[model samples]
Target: MPTPKPSILIQLDSDPQPSVFDGVVAVDSGVEHLFRHGGVQPDAVRDLVYGALFTRGPADLQRTAIFVGGSNVAVGEAILKEVTKTFFANFRVSVLFDANGCNTTAAAAVLAALEGAGGVLNGVSTAVLAGTGPVGQRVARLFGRLGARVALGSRQLDRAQATVEMLGQVNGGRFTPFSTSDEDSLANGLAGVQVVVAAGAAGVTLLPEQVRRSLPDLKVAIDLNAVPPLGIEGISATDKGIDRGGVRAWGALGVGGTKMKIHKRALQELFTANDIVLDAEEILELGRTTLG
Candidate 1:
């Protein structure tokens, strides 16, 4: 019998210190050896990627994978782009990018919304509050991928419009830009909205209790902020699908379990192949399988 090769995972992070959360999950998900790099820049990614590629033969390359993570998603994105630039025709290791947990978290939130909508979002009116940030935009993109009529809510119209424009169209999913600076604007913009995802910053309230209760058509409300004074006034941090004002509400921690699952699953899957880039859409597919 041949000796089995050990699975090796190289974690490249743009932060000063790599995330302990991600490190713990890597261990928990059965990564045999973990190599970590911190404060990585886009220009500096090629050497590290080259080390991974050159160390293993073509068949054993599948045992090695790359995990890109950091607190700043933009920086991580740059590093991801540079990492891909180092790949040749058939000499790339599988890579997973989940900067600040955005990919998995966005996937989980969208899955929660799908569960709320009875497993369908095609043509559904969905509003993503604070939808210009990293997680918010990715959440909007995922929903748009699912064929939802998405409205991106931001304090500034231009920022919201930028996010909508970045997404463009996904399988003809419509994206509308709206403002959430004031109650009147918020109320007016969110008219006839069936689902609301509050992805605002911590301690910032994007959707008030009154406005939420007044939405006659809102069937689901997900608040992704896990701090004091949550993104949605009536949502609890531990809420996993609790009913709030006749809406299925999910809190940050509620969706976090699924996010972690998708994260670990992505890690476990890396050893299976060396050609995949597990980004938002791929993570969403993992979320769908997890939820199913």
Candidate 2:
């Protein structure tokens, strides 16, 4: 038998320290050699990508891949764009962008919400709290793509509208902006919605226990905050599938296991082909396969 090709993953991070979460997942996904670079700016991507391209021939290029990650999705997206610019025909490596694990996390949360809402997302009204944030925006987009009538909520109405507009432009789905700065507004925004997801910042409570329990049409609620206070009140970090006030509820750790599985599966898929680019839609499809 010929010698086995080496499996190498180049991790490019925008932060000063590479993400420990991403590093651990890469190793768990069967990457034998991980080359990590921190504080990687968009300007420096070409040289770094060139290094990976030149070292491997076409047949073995599949063994190498790139992962772009950072705390900021915008910066990570820019880096991903620059990385793609360096690739040409027959000389490209598979790449994935998970900045702050937003893509996988969002995909998993949406999947969990759908599961809680009785396995169908089409025509279901859903509200995403903190919709201007990276994960919230992704969740909104994914839900809209699946035919859910998505209301992207933010503390600032302008921000929510901007995100809704952006998602509409890219995903061509039904998305509306809702101001959720206060309980009255949040209640109004969530009115008649079947699913509510709190993807807000750490330690901030987007939905109070009483408010969540009072939503008449709410069938499922998911909180993606693992920090203190939590995103959705009365939900613990480890809650997988629990019923609260007649609504199915899931906490951060509940959705986290699926996210981790999706991330690992996406990484493994990179080695199956040399041209796979696992972004939000591709990663979400991988998550869907896991459900079946």
Candidate 3:
């Protein structure tokens, strides 16, 4: 048999950070010949990606897959789309777009929501806080695709509407956007909702404890803010994947365990075939495989 094919992952970044280095480690779980380079400019990504493709041995290159990730989700997507047009059309290669672990992390969080809801996502009313952002958008999309009535919440009504439109395009109009800029609006958004996820910016509290406690119909509340001033109030940073109150609550760290698992598994999946594009739907399916 031929020597085991070498694998490589290219992390596209606007500004390099240490967190990216950790992300690389997770991606390298099943990959070989792990090489990293930064300072990727949108206008020049084609040649840069081409260089990585051709410089390595042609045989090893066949097993190679590209993973695009960065903090700037919109910019990262623009670059990845361009890269796809140039590289995928001309060459045979597998690639994935997972800016800020958006695909995998969102998949894990949604899986947690399903698990917290007794392994059923159909007909569930799930609320996604800060749903206009990258991760939040992916979570909303996944929830919509899984047959849940998704409430996409945002501080700006227009932004929420735009997000709902975008997600609906992918999910065939299954999500409804809600404005949660104030206490009353947030309370209204949470009304009759069974699942709540806070994917807002770091150091911001999107849902307060009283609101969480008042939701008698709530089944699970997951906070994806790993920073201080947790996204969902009353969720401790150290919370494990456990049940709390009448509703099961999960902090950022609580959901991270599954996120990391999905990330590593996504890397392994890149080598399963030469044509797989591990987007949100694929990532969510991978997360489901790991669920008990």
* Candidate 1 per-residue lDDT over residues 70-184, each given as its tens digit: 9999999999999888999889999999999999999999999999999999889999999999999998998888889999999999999977887885435389999998999
Rank order by TM-score, top first? Answer: 2, 1, 3
CA RMSD, predictions in order: 1.1, 1.0, 2.2
Report the number of backbone clashes for model 1.
0
lDDT of 2 at 284: 92
The lDDT of model 3 is: 0.79
Those runs of model 2 whose alpha carbons end farther than 4 Å from true positions after fitting are none
Q: Estimate each model's TM-score.
A: 0.98, 0.98, 0.91
Candidate 1, TM-score vs. the true structure? 0.98
Poorest lDDT segment (10 consecutive residues) of candidate 3: 14-23
Clash pairs of candidate 3? none
Q: lDDT per residue, candidate 2, 1-292, as tens digits?
A: 7796889999999999999989999999999999999999999999999999999789999999999999978999999999998999999999999999999999999889878877889999999999999999999989988889999899999999888889999888599899988999988888899999999999999999878877899989899999999999998898887987788889999999999999999999988877889888889999989767
- For every model shown, the clashing-pair count is 0, 0, 0
Q: 40, model 2: CA deviation in Å?
A: 0.3
The residue pairs found clashing in candidate 2 are: none
